[model samples]
Target: MAKQVAKTNAVRLIEQQKIPYELLSYQVEEGQPVDGISASEKIGYSYEYVYKTLVTTVGKSQYYVFVVPVAKELDLKKAAKVVGQKKIEMIAVKELLGVTGYVRGGCSPIGMKKLFPTYIDESAETLDFMIFSAGKVGMSLKLAPHDLVKACKGNFADIVS
Candidate 1:
């Protein structure tokens, strides 16, 4: 029998909106690092097509979500400019769960506790499909880039270095 995969909030939201996606899963050893790059490799996907969801803050309350390829790094200045903020910084690891209701390796831009303004790197704009965390450490979601943007109410921007 095939193992049944549990649905996460990100998966549920995608389904509720009738967005088509493929769920990918891999083994995650206890205490092993589950970074985006490792996730892409484990899932047999290219780093260019796998994105990492990052949460940043403008002040104490305003939050933003950025989705960029696992192979790239977010350009803080450009990200701030895209969001129209003078300055923005990544939320600390300790604050991630409380702020977005997601742990580090499981953060997905799709279904945060609140729908913050989200931006996807322009690099992904031309891809037929991309992958991101399924709100869990060992699972991922694969879907069209445009579909992801539409589902998250996000815009495409050059927010990577």
Candidate 2:
């Protein structure tokens, strides 16, 4: 039997925007890695097509969202420079839900409690579409990169190494 996953805020927002997407779900057991890279392998998508949503804060109040390929590491200096901040660091895990309205492994660039400035890696611009978490650990979404950027009001930048 297959367990039905409930729709997440991310999914609802995508639908409301009339964006096209494919929902892919995988089994998640206790203590398994649900990070984007593992998700790519688990869901049988190439690592390049799997992107991750990361949240970082500038000072105490300003937050920025970054979407990068799962296999790449965010360049902190470039990230800070692109966002026009002195420095930025990843928000603590405890702050993920409070700030983004999503858990660590389920954070998506869309449908957050508030809209923060968002940046997608330049690499994604070359791809027609990409996959990201659906604001839930066991679910993922595949959608056009341009549609995602338009839906989230994000721009492409060289934020990852």
Candidate 3:
């Protein structure tokens, strides 16, 4: 039998929206670097299905969120264009907890302190489902990209480079 993981803010929000999702858990080996590719392998998901949530800021005061495959980088220019901002920069690691209420490796687009404008890579729009962090390290959620977009009030854009 498998142990049940506690619900996270992301899961709670999904439940509130009455959207379905599958939860996956994996071990985080001590002292080893954990990244999207390793997370996909650990969670038994394809690279294309595994997405990572990134929090970025526009200029000084505005913030935005983006989701992209772990293997790809966010195209800053496209991101700025899609979000209608002059410039966007990844939020510093030190500010993750305070800004988004999540750590770097466990950030989720859902249940953010504020619903910052979010964009998912257009590549995921064609897929049936995508996987992303469940607002916690060592855990992931699998759900339809449409459902996620609705739940997060986000849209799809060509934000990946």
Please name the candidate that would achieve the greatest TM-score relative to the true structure: 1
Looking at candidate 2, what is the lDDT of residue 109?
97
* Candidate 2 lDDT for residue 90: 92
The Cα local distance difference test for each model comes to 0.93, 0.92, 0.92
lDDT of 1: 0.93
Q: How many residue pairs clash in each candidate?
A: 0, 0, 0
Model 3, CA-based lDDT: 0.92
Expressed as tens digits, the lDDT of each residue in 1-161 for candidate 3 is 97778999999999999999998999997776689999999988788899999999966679999999999999999999998878889999999999999988999999989998999999999999999999999989999999999999999999988
Between which residue pairs do clashes occur in model 1? none
Q: Model 3 TM-score? A: 0.96
Q: Give each model a TM-score.
A: 0.98, 0.95, 0.96
Clashing pairs in 3: none
